[model samples]
Target: MLRIKGTIGDWPVDLSVEMDDADWARLAQNLPTVAVAPSAQVAAQPAAAGPADKLWLAAQDLLRRSGSVEGPELMDELEALAGSTGAAKGLLVRLRHSPKVKIEVRDGVQVFNWVEE
Candidate 1:
């Protein structure tokens, strides 16, 4: 697996793409086109909790898909989710504390393999 750590516009973004080195560079070159659009009109109340909700749901989905999602990979995915959603770090910590969990140890490193059915 290849990982790249860097900042995005001083936001201190750490991005990890699934692609190998060559592809990662290609993807990076293609990234400048994306933009964040501001809301058209200011809302009286907070827009919504969609991002936070998505973050938690994604965490659960990653755990539930251990048949295809490896433990280490799940952690990576969760971190990315948290970054994109601005979800509290506590979400990941809480997710890890779920009693119904499955894991494996490799060279003293713990990895999640699946979630309890």
Candidate 2:
């Protein structure tokens, strides 16, 4: 398995690819070769966390700690954490689509629950 984490422009990129030795060898066989002196190699830099990432962590923590919270109440907390209504709503939408979160309507109110894996 190969994991790649980086940013493109302003967007974050995180991906993983699984390849066996034979698959890797096949890929290498199709690629062009270039020779470079050892001194030409450059060290890789780690990707930096952005503000949206910070807010995401906080939002996940909020739901996890609460066990369950009403959607409106969660939005209020997210708004404070993100410092803007749009940003908070964006986070809410992200949570709605996340595999670890579950949303249900109870008494006509939407509730978000963090599912433990």
Candidate 3:
């Protein structure tokens, strides 16, 4: 049996799952394993930009191009660009606190603007 309790935003989550021995055995059997060739294993892995890096760059570009953008509108655009609401929200929060960003409330809504140097 597995139990999980947590909160996502304002919502509470409580989940319980049970697995028998056979279930665990089947799951273990189906788990994936990587088989690297000896020659390939010796090769250096290429540096790749992670999702967060890409998202940060995209967010910076968006803010720079738009000058100032409404919070909801920015969130929508970010969600489309990042392909996930959670990622968009995380980026927005980071942007909100970034020293390079300027936040203001306009007509009861938050507006985010890139601070020009």
Candidate 4:
């Protein structure tokens, strides 16, 4: 069972979904799984960082060094860092949702800023 409650624009939304065991089995089968390390093995090694983690770090570094930057300029810099407009957009979306960053509108333009921990 799943329940979702939120507001869409000015409208309130409430949703509910119920699934049987078979449905859950189908969902699980469609999902990807990661291999887990044994307790001792895990404690002995640090987790590996993937490409997305590297890109995210670079994006954060860019914003931190700039202090604050307008959306368009930030997008331009992200595009260069990501090497593609599509990937840059993805990074921008991730940053927008990140706890370490904040977005504000000033002079009718959106600005992205790094939130120091």
> For this target, which candidate reaches the highest TM-score against the unseen true structure?
4
- Candidate 2 deviant stretches above 4 angstroms: 1-47
User: Compared with the true structure, what per-residue lDDT tens digits does model 4 show for residues 24-88?
Assistant: 44543433233222343233444574345455566777788788999999999888777778777
Tens digit per residue, CA lDDT, model 1, 1-117: 334577788777666545454653343333212122223222222557344333444456556655534445666766565553223234444454555555567777666544555
Positional deviation of 80 in candidate 1, in angstroms?
1.7
Question: Which candidate model has the greater lDDT, 1 or 2?
Answer: 2
Pairs that collide in candidate 2 are: none
lDDT of 2 by residue, 2-115 (tens): 566899999999998776757544543433222211121111212363334444656677788898999999999888766678767766766776678999999999999999
Pairwise lDDT winner, candidates 3 and 4: 4
Query: In angstroms, how far off is 82's CA in candidate 2?
Result: 0.5
lDDT of 4 at 48: 71
Per-residue lDDT of candidate 3, residues 9-95 (tens digit): 999999876766565445333322222222321233333733344445556677877999999999998777656787676567667
All candidates: CA RMSD (Å):
14.3, 16.6, 13.7, 10.9
lDDT of each: 0.47, 0.67, 0.66, 0.69
Single out the weakest 10-residue window by summed lDDT for candidate 3: 33-42
Candidate rank order under TM-score: 4, 2, 3, 1
Sorted on lDDT, best first, the list reads 4, 2, 3, 1
Q: Give the TM-score of each candidate.
A: 0.41, 0.59, 0.58, 0.60
Better of 2 and 4 by lDDT: 4
